[model samples]
Target: MWADMAADTRIRRTGLLERYHATRNFLGLDSCVAASAKYSTEDRRPLTKDILFPALRQVIKTHPPLCVGLANESSSTAAFTRLHTIDLSRIVQFRDNDSLRDALESQLAEGFDTDADLPLWRIQVLGDNTVIFAIYHIIGDGLSTIAFHASLLRALRDVPAGDASPLVQTPNTILLSPPIEDVTSVRPSLSTIFDEVYRLFAPKYLSSDRKAWSGNPVPMGVNGSLRTNVRLMSFPAHEVTAFCTMCQTHRTTVTAAFYVLTVATLSRMLAGDPRYDAISSTVAISLRGAAGIPKDAICDYVSAHRTYPPADPRFSWPAAAHHAAKLRTQKSKARENIGMLRFLLGQYVPFFRSHLGRKRASGFVLSNLGRFDASAVEGTWNIVNTVFAQCDVVVGAAFKMNVVCDPTGALNIALTWGEHSIESDFVESFLSRFQDAFRGLLV
Candidate 1:
């Protein structure tokens, strides 16, 4: 009898572990959205505590998993066994946008200061029904934000919880087996790697080097500094797809093409000695289902791969495409050895976090979220637009160009920069250059 009881307990524990693993894998790859709104006095007339709070409460109840994080070795799964209450607060009013900006700046300055052991979320009301919600990137990605927005709309429309489709699940399988070998292969040597990383990421260029420009420069009379500008741009769905097809012909992904093009354009724009060589960009590769790994167990199996573009001014599209294909192949091999690399790094140089501030080894980031169901929920609530909030990067070296695609075939591209680094016009020019490159490829 004693033996039987012990066996049963062990079995239950194992099952729980599996579930937790699945939840973590799902949550980690997710990005976050810090959404805020401003409301006028007239609009406040219909706002009621009962109506707004209850609706929010309802949304929370239905999406309770959003408040949970990965607890253990399990990567992408959500287990209800461990849950945390996210503090949702309501502030009455702010004197002006400066006040609002200050409050947000303070929050970001803390840098994930909330409970690390538990999943956390927060909601702050600026005034009336005007609220801002800061979701940790651990729970959702840009694509997931769209899903959350859709879920909110459905909940507002009184859609039955049972009727909603389940969030897409990416399989998670532990690929880091024979862990020691995997660790050794990818581990960057402490001395050499850090030097390389530093040289690549540290900021050397000044804002004055390029013509200064701003799109919404802290609108005149605004007391505070502009935290950052969030802009939205969409490519014609069909046109982007057509361009992707061209990339497919070269056996390269659209993301690879984007990275190559970005490097080329930036090199041209910067136009100088250091800019001539290959620019290193980081690529976030999804480890879902790779090497027969189960999706439920994979959480943050993402490894950043660097791609170097040809320095020659005469580099052609086909030549660039060929190089990208080769780089992708090399990176794929490197990923297979991720386990060994991680273990070795942890053992030899545990504190070595890649410094994105180094410009020599790091150029920019290109992230492809693959496809999401964009049109999944519509006519339920008015979605003015969808955009992604940038992730935190090193101050000097953190300029980013991110691209995400939705199931409805929309491609959203965003350029995020360091607060003090580049002006908004640089971003606009980069976008224009991206479009021109895409057109060039198409032609």
Candidate 2:
């Protein structure tokens, strides 16, 4: 009984990642989501304990996402305990590019850690001196993980080095949640249920014949067979600024712009079939800031938000912006972000829903972390180019596009798709064409 109370200190109560994690366990899929940040330090020295420990201790003390355990996993529900004493030596480190790639690939391929208590996040050092901090999606969302590293870097720059004291690991400090209405009791309306009907049944997608990131026909990356490839693209600081300016001009978020581009790219790859019109995409949103969660809190509040496709395939930045603006409004009005996970209580889930010929609502996910303040990581450990991405997609989402920019304005984009989607070359080709199209609009 005492153990359970101790565990509560580590277990997060409001997170939705564990629901998906438990579901993945039931369905036998790799449920892990790897959120990583790549950075270049000014000094090419090897990362040492002094360089990394401050952030490590901070993560241990405050971040609940890295502490692996689902709150609802009871004895009647596949019970598991919280990971205690995650050794920094074991949890964080530096590695070469090949080793780093192998480590990340292995992390993505595994369904779950054998040591259930093993922490989900890790740090690595590339041969070229880039620092990549990765966290399992179960604990933190796109925003939390990014925010964690930002704080870590800030600690390095702001916290006086020698003055840093060892943080006592007292995990029981729970934040008192503010008074908020019970959104769940409102119940989804009949129209909302019907909307789910269409969402569950008539979900839009690029045709199967479409080329994969490798350019060959996308492999049959079905259940237990969804192989995924990772690819990267970056826009110079100036270009990113221009894109931001364009977004400002159009009054749309960067994500909406990319969402439109994702739909348009898929359309072109599928040969402009009218069926490609209004292809669906998922936007990953962070609920912490809006929900009043502190920036320093280690909580996962990411929600898979189904978004409306671009109304017009034509390339007008303003038109795309308008569509994006509407999506932003729709996301807020629907309140689906906070309430959608309630469906997990259903007797049958997405995988089962597919047998009815209504494939579970799997679509591409576009997670835009927006921009990071790179200045903190710059003075001593300067940052050059960086990349952000999600390597694991065991969930229903078929493809993931992670976009973020640094303080320098360099836009870093990473894409990972199920082998069934298209070959890697196809992804490259698709991006080239999309860039050309977007360039035309910019000009």
Leading candidate by lDDT: 2
Supply candidate 1's per-residue lDDT for 219.
19
Q: Worst lDDT window (10 residues) for model 2?
A: 209-218
What are the lDDT scores of the predictions, listed in order?
0.44, 0.55
lDDT of 1 by residue, 1-443 (tens): 22422221111111221232232222221123343332223223333443344445556555543434333323222222233243333222223233444444443332332225434445455443344445654433333444455555445456332322222221121111221222234444465455455544556452221221111111122112224444455777788789778777777777667766776777667666552455545666644334343322212234456555544433255765775676566554545434333333223211122222222234566666655443434433333333344534322134566566644576766555545445667777877876776677666
Taking all chains together, each candidate's TM-score versus the true structure is: 0.57, 0.78
Score candidate 2 by lDDT.
0.55
Q: On a 0 to 1 TM-score scale, where does candidate 2 land against the true structure?
A: 0.78
Q: Which stretches of candidate 1 lie over 4 Å from their true place?
A: 1-65, 69-81, 84-110, 115-119, 122-134, 138-231, 272-275, 291-299, 312-360, 376-379, 382-384, 395-397, 406-408, 420-428, 440-443
Give the Cα error of residue 410 in candidate 1, in Å. 3.5
RMSD (Å) per prediction:
10.7, 5.1
lDDT, residue 192, candidate 2 = 69
